[model samples]
Target: MHACARVGLDFLDSAPYRIVSTVDLAITPAQLFEVLADENSWPRWATVITKVTWTSPPPRGVGTTRTVTMRGGIAGNEEFLAWDPFERMAFRFNEVSTSSMAAFAEDYRVVPTSRGCHLTWTMALQPANLAGRIGLSLGAPVMNRLFQRFLHNLRRYTDERFSAQ
Candidate 1:
């Protein structure tokens, strides 16, 4: 894998391309965070993700690392920038299978609501070259919709998961 640019929390706000998706789930923040922390839970909701493996040992916190494999065999080595339990978690890719990404980061924030919890997911990226830039620009809209669908999937998965217990 090629090394990607290291990015900080600020990149979540300043990246050239960003997609923010939100969903209100009928689950508590703790339940949502539990799903986020479970490696097996990823592919259940994020259809594009194939696997997630923790590269760092427990207790997960800032600087923890993981490897995520997506559809099409795209893989990313990620380092957590923030890991406030039950509230916020964010990470950035340190290396990726492809060279088209100069930088990539994602932030997930959960807020308690009257009914359950509301999640805001932000994906930020900087293209490595002109080809990458054009591709992302054209695909941004579709990507946003897909991400939103992932959250909806999460809601359904969690409802079924928790309801069965």
Candidate 2:
């Protein structure tokens, strides 16, 4: 699936649409980078991310590849695209195969700013056939909601961690 975690499900309304979201948080790039580096720990921050079985080690860097599973039963392989620690983090995936499930690619990016950082996770999917078109179209708003939730959860996670230190 293009979307990792699932979000709001009020999709009986919209027909054809695309999901695009951008969120900024007030936290050190170092802190944000640490969170992004650990794929297994994703579920801890994203409420919808119930699972993340890592095929790599902590602080994943350039050329690293790992599988990402979400609470909504969505799973995909993520490959590191850019791994500039404390400054940027990005990844791409062409597919995520499973014993019984569909596979797709997802691109993730984290860019540092003067105050804190900006994290963007995006997916581009072209339906296999006209039959799948309805899904991609209806998925836009739902995915956008999931993206918003991710940002909300990320902010909470950062706040809790930084507060404890």
Candidate 3:
């Protein structure tokens, strides 16, 4: 078992905390991307995404950019790190107002499975300092749960919305 599992952790979230979970779903990449790209669809799928006001024109190709605001900060910018059309997209979170203990990178990859699409989302944090490491030890549970909840909702939305398409 991995160190996290040995400690009774099923998974780790990326934001300096590695909490992980595996979800099975039945959805297509195009259908998933349609929802993932629309800023309005965030609240419908992601639990922590309270707001997403587009900072630029909606992007259809790779390298598209958007200033996506999330719930953890006063203002959030979600820069598109990678966008493979209906395949995959990645972005990092930058707080415009609030200063977090750890910064994070989010990678959302959509893999086409025979049954459906497999989404792999990863969030990691930048070690702030020694104190930050200690904070991670304590905050991992909350952060892990938050990420899991987000993924869980995403899976549900994708399965329900996309599978019907």
Candidate 4:
């Protein structure tokens, strides 16, 4: 098991929280998973993820590290904790010196449905300090709205890509 699973449970007890964004796409779970698992394609599909670069070498699976720049120039480093093709994947913010969150975990899952597939993105975050905690509490709604947009963007991108084929 990754160290992340063992740490932060007690630290986050006061602020245990999770934000989830989900979408149903008219595409196979495998197809959607491919797009998500390909880190380089993030900027093309998810506008919020403005840029991505592997800090370490690839065949991107568990333990791969990458730096991601978000919409407003917020850069963070991520480490893949779990990778399960066509089913689910999970990652954590690992080494972003500027990030205010002490611990952040994101898990993405793609589940097959009768028509297509349901994709869910879930994030767990704990601020680094007391002030950071207050800020997150206040801005949670805005953050949630943005996450929804990210999910919708994924759906739009996947649909357009597959339609053109």
Give the TM-score of each candidate: 0.98, 0.71, 0.75, 0.84
lDDT of 3 by residue, 17-136 (tens): 655544556767777778877778897877566777767675455445465555655555545656786666666554445443345456667778998777777665554467768887
lDDT of model 4 at position 121: 84
lDDT of model 1, residue 100: 91
Ranking by lDDT: 1, 4, 3, 2
Q: Taking the tens digit of each residue's C-alpha lDDT, what string does model 4 give over 1-165?
A: 112222332322333667888999999988887787677779876777887887778576788788788866677777777778888877787655554667777888789999899988888877777887898889889989988988787888888889976
Q: Which ranges in model 1 have alpha carbons more than 4 Å from their true place?
A: none
Q: What is the C-alpha lDDT of each candidate?
A: 0.96, 0.60, 0.62, 0.75
lDDT at 28, model 4: 91
Q: Candidate 4: minimum summed lDDT over ten consecutive residues — where?
A: 1-10
Candidate with maximal lDDT? 1
- Which candidate model has the greater TM-score, 2 or 4? 4
Looking at model 1, how many pairs of residues clash?
0
Better of 2 and 3 by TM-score: 3
Off by over 4 Å in 4: 1-15
